[model samples]
Target: MPKAVLALGANQGDPARQLALAGAAIAAHPDIEVLAESSVIVTPPWGKTDQAEFHNAALLIETGLSPLDLLDFCLATEAGIGRVRLEKWGPRVIDIDLIAYDRLEMESERLTLPHPYAHQRDFVLTPLREIAPDIADWLVNRIGTSSA
Candidate 1:
């Protein structure tokens, strides 16, 4: 099994409850095993800052699914949670991002391992640091320290 990191966030419609629902969905997946989860934290909106603050958390999991499959699962999970792609960086009901997949590094039309912007976002890094400090440290160091 390969370990992967995921970042979860919601800024609309009961943010905390939305995160809890996402956690449940992830745990319900037969091919995935939840390893650790970070405490949910409130973060000011990023990208498009006009929305409400977001509830954010991170998850560490061991899974039998391939990276692309995991990405698809995330997308499906978001849609299941009522996410609508109305705008880029727009407010969302739930957002699940596959931040990293083992030590793999690759980018295709649908997915990218070691999420290109994870290091630059504190909402992603802070919760990740709580459950997986080493991975968080590596991401920060790997990408020249984060200013967030």
Candidate 2:
């Protein structure tokens, strides 16, 4: 099983419900096995704080899927939950981001493995750090390891 980490967030609708549904959606995939899911962390906002508060959580997953497969899962989850990617960092109904993938490094026009901005954003790092401070610290220390 390839280890992976995902960040789950919601702000538009019932966040708790969205979070649960997102987890369920991920688990619905036969290849994705959830190891441990961190408790939801409610935060103010990131890029656009003017919108709404966000409920965030980190999910440790094990999957046989490739990086691109995981990215497609995330995008599909967002679309399934009615996410409109109109504005940059705007309000969202649901947002699922692949934070890490078994130390994999990938760069594509569609997505970047080990999310480019995972460290700087408190929304991503805080809940992540809570679930895994050591990994979070490493990501912070190794910011320049990738294109970030």
Every candidate's CA RMSD: 2.1, 1.6
Colliding residue pairs in candidate 1: none
Kindly list the per-residue Cα lDDT of model 2 for residues 1-148, writing each as its tens digit. 8888899999987988988999999999999998878888889888877988999998888998888988898899889988889888888889999988877777889877668888787888877777777667867776646444
Q: Candidate 2, clashing residue pairs? A: none
Poorest stretch of ten by lDDT in candidate 2: 139-148
Q: How do the residues 1-148 of candidate 1 rate in per-residue lDDT, one tens digit apiece?
A: 9999999999999989899999999999999999999999998998988989999999999999999999999999999999999998789999999998887878899887688888889999999999999999888786545323
**Runs in model 2 with CA error above 4 Å?**
144-148
Q: What is the TM-score of each candidate against the true structure?
A: 0.95, 0.92
Cα lDDT of candidate 1 equals 0.91
Error (Å) of candidate 2 at residue 72 is: 0.6
- How many angstroms is residue 137 displaced in model 1 relative to the true structure, after the best TM-score fit? 1.1
